[model samples]
Target: MGKSATAATLALAAARTGRSVLLVEVAGRSATAPMFGAEPPGYEEREVYDDADGGSVRCRSITPDDALVEWLSTHGFRRIVRRMARSGLLEVIATATPGVKDLLVLGRIKALEADDDADLIIVDAPAAGHALGFLRAPVGVRDTARTGVLNRQAREVLEMLGDPGRCRVMLVSIPEETPVNELVETSFAVEDEIGLALGPVVINGIVPPLEGLDEPLPSGPPPGVSDVELTEMGAAARLRRERVALQGEQLDRLAERLPLQQLRLPQVFGTTLGPDELRTLSDALLEGVGSLEAWA
Candidate 1:
């Protein structure tokens, strides 16, 4: 949810600036789809949001099997594609290849970008540990297949990923102990392993400061007439305040350690994030990171 929120916020920001944006979910995850209150996106692209100015954001989930079938179909191997899909051999092959899944997904993204399908594409990449493998797939294939179409495709994808103007990798994290630590480590890993600079570190789930919680509590509940209940409520507020302070401390530590730009998204207090909450998040992102025009 943390990473997906950041991705969706960024997509909305870009769309507001009159740009056609594509929000992609890699790693076969459903985080982005649920945020938009839609069924999880399948292999094909679907419009998720449309703005008044004729700008829109589309979402799609890419998987190795689907990409392979699409690729084969384009090459006049439709029957083979169907056979592989129906026989369950596609999953086996995708599983056997270490980074092919990631490479296929990257190829899809590059095609979308190159074909002018979207002015901007925001990818909700895998979590830190798996993301490293995903980012390295292009380089791995480029190095191994030196004289074939695969090698050429890999080279192109690598160029797109390494181009700062074209691609910016953002790391999303929460203001918690483990997520913060993983963000730091993943930042380093991305730079060292993938040779790409992180654009920003989006810190989500920030607890808003509690107002009027510091004042002295009344001796008794005004209408409920239960001192015990009042005391419990006060205790809960104090605990929430403490948590907010701790999160602030964690943010400070992250700022001191990481040299990347940081953006904070407040903790959304609800069971699910709908259009309203997404708009609220986009507003926060715009305030913190400025307009998406700069990126465009």
Candidate 2:
């Protein structure tokens, strides 16, 4: 996945099919805001993209601190919540507890899932390492706490996460050595360790096939070009071609190893991705996945 770019594109793809989609950023990163040209979202979901058919994409960034506050408020601890926020006790609790932070974040997601505000809730989870921990947090808590509200909450979250119909974890990767390797390991961890149904793997930033590149390079620049510049350009092109070939090999390896559906998104060359680029990627995604109804 291109991370935020991929998340935003997927959300847009769902919204284009006249479905309400909620994009959640669980890594405390703000990728959807900039993609939609809006300010960073807080705990509250805000409409980032509105489809012509009355469907929309709402995005929110969920952090441990904010989730804790929300939890406290819901439990009739508004005064305590304010004091904790002012004294930085919230941060302390979020930091001190190993998996509690992740639990709180998932709790928030569970609330959204129960609310049924959107047809699809796409969580732009953390990277593979932290994401694995996040998904496993509930199970860890459930096992540690024999009896309590915490144990009950953890069980509920675990059920939702493990449900095949409700939850699907999608892994995103670039066609490279390190990222692909990490993705392969992460996929195993998701199914084996986390016990969740893994969804499609989106291979992002794939280099398109370069046509007419089999011919040998010219001896020199065609006109008004220095030898040094031409040589450097040739080297760069050769490197790009080599990288594309290597990426293809990596993709093949991933396909062979993992049985999940694979989708490829071409590398969009641009400094910033706007709606136009996102639309293009979304179309590619729909084409690869077959239909939006399938995702829902």
Candidate 3:
């Protein structure tokens, strides 16, 4: 669904408004850095973009193992956890407890939120399926542990997730059938099961329709062009028109199925996306964000 790029674009858009933004990746992936033409960041935060104003965007990757280690170390169990980690027991611990690993990661994010680490923190969560489990982890852990520090932490994270002022879940999907179907389901799950407020849904990879696609081709080729090229061009245009119509049908289906506002992102033509493409995307995102009544 291109959430990593969306995260980067949203961070830059916020930064342009003189707001410090922290872009976090939870799955240990480094997809966002390349958009800014920067290197992959470790757990430690690195400044990827600095606007001329006081705004900036910092990025970091947070894995469950690393988050668990940091959480334990903060509670004065550094030596013990380090030994367990070395013995490969960490994997066992994370796997044995269904939602503990995810809770640990969310705990770190909660701490950042509480401490006001940045004006905004954008977490690039896992894909749709994993994301549902990711967001529901705190609730599961809280219910499992009736009395303990883990319970307390899980409850706090749950509170943050449910609070509209503190957090909002934004589901991303491309303008296609299967993705849109999954997105609609995920949106309902986030609202009904997780009880979280939703931000605008992001519709990525929207191909703008070409003009004069319906215009009939001339009988003969124009200057500096052959008849064969003209026929091929017409065929390509017709294909594009078909694709645009398909996208429109999917868009309409999404709107009817889900009641959330949408933010549309244009598809980049180049094979690779860089700073220039990122800037274009961020501008489009900013325009969409601005149009929202809540943001306004």
Candidate 4:
């Protein structure tokens, strides 16, 4: 679905507004760093892009194990953090408890939010199913802990997740049947179940409609083009036309079902997704942002 690329583009878009942006990946995949032409960043945030107008983008990756160790160390359990890690107790605990790992990661993000480290933070969350679990972790912990530091931390994380002014989920999806269906379902789950506010949906990988796709192929091959080559070209053109029509249908259906504004990103071809690609997508993202009433 190009979520990582979209996150990087969004970081660039936000940075262009003279706001510092932090791009965070919770799944431990340092996908954003590569797009910025940088090496993978670990737990420490590293500057990826610097805007001329005093804004910039930084990126970091957070894993559940690392978060848990840090959480324990900061919460007065520092003495046991090493032991727990060395003995693999941390993994056991995280696996046994359904949402503990997610809660730890969210807690760290909550702390970052509280510290005012960046003007805007874009989290490259996991896929739809895990994202739901990730958002719901704080709630589960808050309920289970009830009256301790853990509960307090969970409550604070929930506050961050639920507050629209502080945070909002931007869902990314390709224009297709199953993905669109999942996006709609996830939006509802986030709103109805988690009560988290949503930002504009990003529709990635839109293939621009070619002007002459509907016209018939030439009756005969041109110079240097064989009949077989022409036939293949016609077939490819037909596929493109069908794909464009299908994407249009899905986009319309998405608007009717989701009702939120969408930011459409053109399908990038042939490029290896480096700084140049980020700039192109960022420009497109900013244009889409400009059209939204809230952003304007």
Best by lDDT: 3
Alpha carbon lDDT of each predicted model = 0.83, 0.86, 0.91, 0.90
Name the Cα RMSD for model 3. Answer: 1.4
Residue 279 in model 1: lDDT: 89
After superposing candidate 4 on the true structure, give the runs of residues whose Cα lies further than 4 Å from its correct spot. Answer: 92-96
Top candidate, metric TM-score: 3
**Model 3: runs farther than 4 Å from truth?**
none
The candidate with the higher lDDT, 1 or 2, is 2
Clashes (backbone N, CA, C under 3 Å), per candidate, total: 0, 2, 0, 0
Tens-place lDDT digits, model 2, residues 1-296: 57778889889989998999999998877878778777778888888899899779999999888888988888888868888889988889776546889999999899999998899999998877688888889888888777987788899999999999999988999998889889999989999988999888899998887775666778768788888888887787888889889998999899888877788888999899988889889989989888423543
Flag the better candidate by TM-score, 3 or 4.
Answer: 3
How high is each candidate's TM-score?
0.91, 0.92, 0.96, 0.95
Ranking by lDDT, best first? Answer: 3, 4, 2, 1
Error of 4 at 111 (Å): 0.4
Model 3 C-alpha lDDT per residue in residues 246-280, reported as the tens digit of each score: 99999999999998888999998888889999999
User: What tens-digit string does per-residue lDDT give for candidate 1 at 126-226?
Assistant: 87778888899988888877777678878889888888888888999998888888888888888877888668788898889879988888866889558
Clashing pairs in 1: none
